[model samples]
Target: MMKKKLWSLGIFIILLSIIVYWFYFSKPTSFPTNEQLVAEMNRVFPEATASIIQDTIPIDERHVLAPFISKGDDYGLSYWVWKNHKWKVASIDTKGKPMLWKLNKSDPSSFYFVWNIDPKDQISSIHFYLIRDRGYQITRGIQHYNPKVQMGKRVSLQEKSYGLMQLSGTWVTFMNAYNKVESAKQYPERNMFFGWIPYDQKDMGIFPENSVNGASYSNGEIGLEYLMIVDKGQIEIPR
Candidate 1:
């Protein structure tokens, strides 16, 4: 009976140790306050204001060491802390367009911008002001090319122009000036040309009503218009 009790005690002690270790070391830490986040941003850019809000997607799930989150609806900014380090801007989007930017260690405070654009919008570029951690200020210095729209309405056999590569899984398209539509009879080969686009989807191609097939349009003055459409389970129209 004494041996049995000793064995049970040993098991209990091991379980307790595990529990204690989990509570002391394995549990996640707390995040910084919203005010602190704003203060950090202000330290970099005095003219900047901050607002805080909860991450809609629970950013903590992605980061094991996420800082405290500041949710402010009054201002258009949010703040957070993680890994004992603090940053002012976690993410930002202007108007309807998304600003392509990210922070890396080498360019910690330096942000690179890409314009997340829609082909329908006429504005082809983005502009912003960035303030480095060292108080050096510079304007957004990138020019993003607009996605290609449908070329003219006509197509010819000798034309080499196909069209811009469409971004996979997205409604964004890249139109090329040289590409024009070609009929299956001219080449007797029907294959859609794929161009380089970020996040290229494997199932992208030309569509002809029910099937994803390369297509062309022939307008009188515009000549041949070559187009490639991506189709998987469903068809999508570029926005």
Candidate 2:
């Protein structure tokens, strides 16, 4: 009978040890507050005095993503990771485009794409075009040529607000572009060719669209922001 009681006590002690370890050492020591996040952004950017942290997404208890618009009208995405008992900026991409594409290291065939597009009034759908051909030829020098974008499906959305589409797939790898349309093949006024907009025809072919994203139009022409994640599979998009 004494041996039986001792065995029960041993099991209880082991379970208690696991529970205590998980609650204390295994779990996070602490978490950051909203105000602390804002301060961390400031610490990342020296000239971010007027830049406020907006639309922050926490990927995990130790990682987060955010967008910062500077006082001079500059904007980009900032990724932060909690380390050494504080949140630290992992890396910052200064690309003006609000589109982010993440490539999977282990599996080359799988990847994730995200877009925070600003659709004008009457916009109903957004199209993702896979880029396999350049808009211009570069054998001799820079020349204006038509862009042959691979066929990509369109995602529908309502207007008077923005649209968001987040999906994971093994298709549409490499360079891509997106545009807002009222209907099929409509709204040719502007397109974003982020892979690299070729110098060519304005408002002709994929001009304004190409120019709209890649280094063509100034930051004034941009309306949306994009966030990217690696190792993170899925996330909720805010409206």
Clashes of each: 30, 2
For the record, the alpha-carbon RMSD of candidate 2 to the native fold, in angstroms, is: 14.5
Best by lDDT: 2
Mark the regions of model 2 whose C-alpha exceeds 4 Å error after superposition. 1-31, 60-63, 82-86, 93-96, 99-104, 107-111, 114-126, 133-167, 170-239
- Give the TM-score of each candidate: 0.24, 0.41
Candidate 1's displacement at residue 143, Å, is: 31
C-alpha lDDT of candidate 1 relative to the true structure: 0.28
Q: List where candidate 1 sits over 4 angstroms from the true fold.
A: 1-28, 51-57, 61-81, 84-239
In candidate 1, what are the lDDT values of residues 1-239, reduced to their tens digit? 99999999999999998877765446344444545555655555444333432222223322211111213212122222232132224432211122222223222122222222222222222212211111222339654332222221111212211111112222112211112332324552223232111121232222222111211111122111222222332222256
The TM-score measured for candidate 2 stands at: 0.41
Q: Candidate 2, residues 1-239: lDDT per residue as tens digits?
A: 99999999999999998877765456444556556755765665554442555566654565455655445544445555555444566654332333433333233232233322222222344444333333565556766565554434455544312222333242333322222231245434233232321111121112222112322112222222333211111212234
